[model samples]
Target: MIEERGRVLSVEAGAVWVETVRTSTCGSCAAKAGCGQALLSRVGSGAKRGFIRALTDRQWQIGDEVFIGIPEDAVVRGALWVYMVPLLGLFASALLAQAAGVAEPGMIGAALLGLAAGFAVVRWHGQRAQRDPQMMPQVLRSAGQVMPFAPEGRLNG
Candidate 1:
């Protein structure tokens, strides 16, 4: 499970609104001093956003610091086909068509069809994946002695 901590902004019977801290990866880039991403981050450092999601039969109150859990398997499987399948399909279609003496137009169509099929596969898999128990997120109260949820790291005393 992958866990993140966030503060509850509001709570309803079936859902809780939380605001999570956003952190940028630009700080670790080798070219941070010259990268456009770093420049943008410097200009946008203090901006914060709110996120809202429905809870699964769990009740939380405003000001609660909750730990949100996402299953590791779901993330790994989702990333794999979402990125790799479409790329492989496009490459294979183009290569096979060219090897068989297919014309440029025909090859283009085949590649496009492959890409479309890849997207359809991903969409279909996503729907089915959501129905799987491992894909859901669960909210839990942090360990004893609650502390404020920090966006960047563990709560500081």
Candidate 2:
């Protein structure tokens, strides 16, 4: 589970919207003196607001701090589909063409076609999954305590 502290901004039905702080690691960069990221960081200090939703069953009071967790299964399943499908498709297409006596150039074309098809499939699946409520992450609030996802002093409140 990945945990972070955030303040509740709004609650509607079964979801609570919370704002979390943003952080960056450009401060320690050896090229800070010459880097664009460092220049932006110096100018703005890099704090930003992000909203997260907690299920309605969870109780959250306005201005309250809460901890959130992202489930492990969600992480693993997402990884497998994103990385595995394309490679498998390319390999299968190449092997099939070779076995069928296709010329080298033709086989290469087939492999490229397979890779493109695989990427398309993965992208389509991801978009569909995002729209499905059952595929959304399950969020749980911490024990009546607000935890700052990013360090304090970053938010206006």
Candidate 3:
């Protein structure tokens, strides 16, 4: 299970909206100086405050802290959907366009068209997954279990 700490922004029926600072493990690691995630952290200084609605059984009040959990399988699947599908689409479309004896410009256009098609499929899949509980993140534990807040200086720069 992948876990994150967030503060409840609001509570509604069956779920709560949570706000969290986006951080990777490497961001807090002692050896961060050599970590790629640390490098990304340094570069991703502008990463926005992320918000998500998480299903929770426990009653929570505004600004209450909670831990959010997402399954590893779900994370892997999401990553593939976001990165791999478009790549495959680009290659497949280019090959198909070439097989059709299209000119170079046409081939480029076809590849781009394929990329769009892939993104379209991803969008459709995302809509469907919205209703799938297995893909959704859930409230895991209280703030006591996880750190209530991230390191302060880390967030600003």
Best TM-score among the predictions, by candidate number = 3
Question: lDDT rank, highest first?
Answer: 3, 1, 2
Name the weakest run of 10 consecutive residues (lDDT summed) in model 3: 148-157
Q: Model-by-model lDDT, in order?
A: 0.73, 0.73, 0.84
Q: State each model's C-alpha RMSD to the native.
A: 5.0, 5.6, 4.9
Where in model 3 is the C-alpha error above 4 Å? 24-48, 145-157
- The C-alpha TM-scores of every prediction are 0.71, 0.64, 0.77
The positional error of residue 49 in candidate 2, measured at the CA in angstroms, is 5.1
Compose the digit string of candidate 3's lDDT tens values, residues 85-105.
888888899999999999999
- Spell out the clash pairs found in candidate 1: none
Off by over 4 Å in 1: 10-15, 28-30, 43-47, 50-57, 143-157
lDDT string, candidate 1, 10-96, tens digits: 677766776666677887788999898889888875765547463646766666777777878878978998998887888888888
Count of steric clashes across candidates, in order: 0, 7, 0
TM-score-based ranking:
3, 1, 2
Off by over 4 Å in 2: 22-49, 131-134, 143-154
